[model samples]
Target chain A: MMREIDADKVAETISGLLQEGCYRLSDDVIHALKLAHEREESPPARHVLGKLLENAEVAARDKVPLCQDTGMAVVFLELGQDVHIVGGDLYKAVQEGTRRATTQGYLRKSVVDRPFSARINTEDNTPAVVHTTIVPGEKLKITALSKGFGSENMSKIAMLPPAKGRSGVIDFVVACVDEAGANPCPPVIVGVGIGGTVEKCMLLAKEALLRRVGDPHPDAEIAELESEILKRINDLGIGAMGYGGRITALAVHVEVFPTHIASLPVAVNLQCHSVRHREAVL
Target chain B: MKNNMPIARAITLPLSDEVLKTLHTGDELLLTGVMYVGRDAAHKRMIETLEAGEALPVDLKGQVIYFMGPTPARPGKAVGSAGPTSSYRMDTYSPRLIAAGLKGMIGKGMRSGVVKKSMKKYKAVYLGAIGGAGALISRSIKKVDVVAYEDLGTEALRRIEVRDFPVTVVNDIYGGDLYQEGRSQYRIADLRR
Candidate 1:
């Protein structure tokens, strides 16, 4: 059963998601923030969290950007095997969506054309980093994450020897957060990728973030690993915005994949307290 | 213990070295008056202009600069979601600006040792605004003007007037660092449970 979906619809949907993602934070983050506010023992970190809650409200109510960076738009597309696209090319449509959203949503044009020399703004925040996957359903899923570089820069990937095993992975992720300190903006949601080749490991770490905040993985062993990592990370006492307190991370999500017998690759992707993302099914 | 948290002071800009001497890391403040806003691109251009032996677009002497680039102002507003960005990216250019008599900076994150030394030598200060709280912070900005590098889009250099803007002293001229002091005060000794 093949369904023809218009490419314009994809663009329009993505544009809307980007605007909404920028204006208001998703509910999961809001809920976790409120919980952190209550659980936090330090007055300073608590106060900062309260202000962040107010910021979220103000942004949503007044339709203002939650953060100035607005970030590079990273979109994940899951195209159903049975769907056919009409009206335009798929990849071009995604870029068009990013461009329109940048203009209409008042997002900052943060993308640069060159990293090495004479770096220039792309002007429209176009050419979004798109990751596509072919899936078995009739519905296409598009998820957009506004990735701020403060945290993105702090993220790390390490190729570990298989002999080091689980504890090494745990230590690396925790050490990354410790070194990151307040720079990534605390109370960050950490995404961990383990057991794949390097690039796949990085992608898996990002994909792990798409899961609802604080939701443990389904597999019992994986879910336990998530809990263990979350505990160690929060134990750093980096606290909200690194003001230092009881809770530094709202959640830690981990995703795992089979890899070469000799390779053990792990990646960490940190999302700031303003974890702005949205998804649509078409 | 709570008394260590300094009461928020009302500060007017062009902060004198004598006044900066009294401030310490972790002191809260509400700032007023004009300040220039610059980010990665604007700072790069300003540094290039300086290195090229040309006068900067604005005189940094005895001035405060905010490391930020706000979103486009909504209709009728002065600016949109004006908040501090990470300051480390500007570290290389900061010491030179401090030497040029820049008095203060508003941004988040830690500063490199070189930048801290410059702050001490130049008698300047570094303040941290609450990161990711831009919407709440923007309400303090009362006026805005594109002072230079307008083509940089959001990274353009802008002159802004803020009233009762909230900030905290992250690095003081006396070598006190709030990020270090604050984090150390709360870091749990136990690495794991």
Candidate 2:
């Protein structure tokens, strides 16, 4: 017998998560920022980090958004194979949840109907970037991230020849950060996706950002790569808000997937220090 | 311990040449007075209006423009969480505004080379407000009014009066860029023994 999960319940859970996620900075992110603040040698960098931490506190205390952008809603769902959703369409439920969350939370409506030509506001911030995967369980897991476009616009990808290898990946990622400079709001958290097809690699890069800051990849070799890439990036001296400082990046999270023998696809997804995300299991 | 103290300077808007000359890269500032808001959509329209040989919605002479699109204000709040957007998107429009007597810009990120050149040529400065510190920054914004292009929603032009709003000098009239100066000061190669 399959477990029957009401779509409304999922919607409600997601709505609550969205409100909380937008208002509250996660502990790991807060911790990493505080650590960065302590370690930062530049006075301006330290001052900016101090203000960011204070901003997080004000948003949490006042029940307001951490940043005005509030961002386009990106939802990651793990649907259980044994669970049957009832009462409504799952996607529609998610949209409904997002609509209520934005209205109730006072989040910004950032989505537009078309990229070019029309450029009409969607108003409710609907049609979230939903990525759903099937898993073997009865529970549905959802993660909601408020992805601000300031950093989103800075994200990039490239296909390197296989022979370039690790050094190639490091150089490309660092170069991306160097080019981004202050635009993406430095003291940035870098997410790297290595291998996989073009699209899959980009997704992997974004998904890597969901990991807690300072948490190393489970694989030792990949973890070392994360550290190396991070060191090179901070070495660029972009610092806080590109004002220059010792701490340009808070952490680098890398996620890898198997790819074609001929392809070494890499993607760099940058996240601002705000780093708003929340998850719920229904 | 000695380097930890930031050099704080207070400035009033509608910036004069004296103020512009005093500003240098890396100086922290708290700004007070009235400023106008505009973003990409408004900028495009402003340029179109300029091309038509018509006046802008607001006179930009001797004024500052903040690159931002704010969240809607709830009841009892002056404005919603207002913060700076990236500055590069406004690069094309900024030179024209600078030529029209715009003296300063507030936003996060680096300016394009063309925009920086215009700043130096026209005696302007670019200040950086904390990118993600919307709520904190909003406290300093005491008044707000929609001045133009209301249909643009958040992208609409706003006339705002701010008090002690925090910012840092990113680019100054002397052709100094804080982004380059800051990076070079702490680059790993410079720090390595």
Candidate 3:
């Protein structure tokens, strides 16, 4: 049996969260940008970085959007088995909340009706990408990660042979980022999903990005490997915005999922310096 | 040495090969005067026009082209949140522009092979603006007019005049790449031990 919660309350909360998240860059993200600016070496890259810092400062001061691509809102929900979502529909509540936020939040309505023709703005940012999973708890936990297309476009999934092992995974990810170079905006957060099916790997990689920066991997051996890989990625000298530097990657996160004995699917999700995400539980 | 240069008022100046050559990798520029705005769509059209041996909508002789797709302006604004889009997408179309007297590019990121080759050969410079800084950048623009491709909406071509628009020289006339130069200076050899 699930206990019911007020739908209007949930909608209000979701709407506020969406607007706040879209309008402001997270503190962690701001800190990372500052750190990147301090560490950047190339004069040109540093100049550009200073501008980015100034932009963030101005945006924050003015209460304006940090980036034009407010991004497609992606909500990860963990529904409590004991809690019932009441009053109207859950998806509609979320969509309406997003719509309200997009309009009032002053976010750009990026979603279009059709892919090819009659491409028109959805007016309000509706139809947010929602992923829900049932959990054992009594609380409904929601996490949102706003993603822009530039960094998202650089995501990669590779079906590597099991024999190639971990080194191969590192190679593939580094190669992808290298090819992506300055395009994805370097000083990136790399999330690696290993040992899952192709689609699962992709999802897992994105999920891994939600992890805190600089947290060590739980598995000791894997932690050591991750450290080594991070060192190498930074060594690629992709730097800030691909201006060559030692801090190309701020952190590398790896998540593993069960896979077929013969297959190892690896996915790399590169997040830019502006990784905007927030979470709340109710 | 750069610290000595006084921060001046933002002003819009015309785009020309001469004005372009005066810029170096770390120079701060407030661009105005005459320049065409284009991105992927406009590039395709420009290339098609070139192939057809037809004159482009805007003359290319000694012009600088900005790579940007801006948000729709608020009521009665010249443009809205206009910022540079990615430059790499225009890599294939750049050499032609340089040959057609396109002397400068404004955008972020790196270009490869022929684009770099063309910049060096044609004496053009690639200026880098901060990515994700659209709102701040838009403040510098005082005027904008649609020159072509209105159907493309944000991706349409426009002529914009900006005052004290900030940019860093990423690719220089001598073939210097600032992106490569910046990272090698700060990357640590090892993180553990």
Candidate 4:
């Protein structure tokens, strides 16, 4: 028996999530900032953390956005094969929802028609970068990540040889952070994708960010590696805003998929302390 | 412990070496009075206008210019999420702006050698607001009026009067750079160890 999925419900969910995610900083992110504050040795870094925390609380209380860059809304959907979307074009519905979210939600309209030349705001943040996947059963999972461009511009992808192994992965990831320094904001959450194809690797890296902060990988070997990377990343001395401190990264999340025998594609997606993401099931 | 520092004292006064000495990396500032707003496009125009032996659209003396391309403000709002962009992009134009009597800049990230050298030579300073704290920062700006390049939309040059805007001192007239100084402290020598 196929389950019926209401399109209006989906649209409402999208609008609600977009507004909530844009305006309020998440608990995990705020907790990470607080932890960074306690661990930060440098006075400047500590002050920066305090300001970020205060800003988050004030923005939440005022029902205003935490950052001015409300960012392009990215939707990752996990649909149950047994569920059917009713009454409309799913793509159009999502776009309309995004539009409403932009105007009513007061999110910044960051989307432009083209990368160059006719660079004009689309007015409404439409045509969200929607990633849909089908799974068994009747439940639908939707995750919205409102990404700011400051950190997005600094994201990098590299394809490495199989020989680089785990050590090489750690080195590459740390080096990427070192080069980025304070640009992406320190105490960053590093999303690492290992062993997938080039494009898949990037997707996996970003998906890794959806994981709860400080959550370890299920695989013992992978979990151990995650711990190692987290330790080394924090040791990078690129404390809060590169002020130098005990903590540079709040967490290192690694997600892996089987890849071609000869390829070890790695992607590093850096999210600043203000990692604005939220999830809802409908 | 916080002090009840008045916002007026910080914003309207002419910035000098003596005034700058009191600030440090990570202090909250609520700048009021006046500041200029310009980005890549207006910067080029300013330089070209200056090279043509013409006066700049706005006087650069005793002022701060934020490097930003903000979203349009709401109906009654003065500005949208108006936070600083990366400072490195404006490194080239900054020296010229400083030479033209610019006293301060607000942005994020580390500046290049040339920008730092110019700040030292010109007795200017660069301040950093929380990169993503745009909403909170905008609350300080009481009024915003586009003084030049209205066609540039969000990137136009504006004369904004703020009340107690917040920022951290990144590069000062004494040639101090908090970004570099902060990074070296966390850099690990041997990953294996």
DockQ each candidate and list the results.
Answer: 0.67, 0.72, 0.42, 0.46
For all candidates in order, the CA lDDT equals 0.89, 0.90, 0.75, 0.79
Each prediction's RMSD over C-alphas, in Å, is: 1.4, 1.7, 3.7, 3.3
Q: Chain A structural similarity (TM-score) per candidate?
A: 0.98, 0.99, 0.93, 0.96
Of the pair 1 and 4, which is ahead by lDDT?
Answer: 1
lDDT of 3 at A238: 72
Query: Pairs clashing in candidate 2?
Result: none
User: Tens digits of per-residue lDDT for model 1 on A56-100?
Assistant: 999999999999889999999999999999999999999999999
Q: What is the lDDT of candidate 3?
A: 0.75
lDDT of 4 by residue, A129-185 (tens): 999999999988888788877777677888999899888888898889888877886
Highest-DockQ candidate:
2
| Per-residue C-alpha lDDT of model 3 across residues A230-261, encoded as one tens digit per residue | 87787777766665655677788888888998
Summarize candidate 2's per-residue lDDT along B66-138 as a digit string, tens digits. 9998887778889878889999999989999999999999999978999999999999999999999998898
- Tens-digit lDDT track of model 2 for A158-246: 99999989989998999999999999998899999999999999999999999999999999999999999999998898898887777
Model 3, span B1-193: residue lDDT tens = 2433334333244555555566565455666566678887789888999999999988877667888877555566666556666788899999998889887888878787799999999898888777778768878778889999887666678887776777767888887777766555555554432
True contacts kept of each: 0.65, 0.82, 0.49, 0.55
The order of the candidates by DockQ, greatest first, is: 2, 1, 4, 3
lDDT of 1 by residue, B33-110 (tens): 999999888988999999999999999899999999888888898888887898999999999999988999999888
By lDDT, is 3 or 4 better?
Answer: 4
Query: Which model scores highest in lDDT?
Result: 2
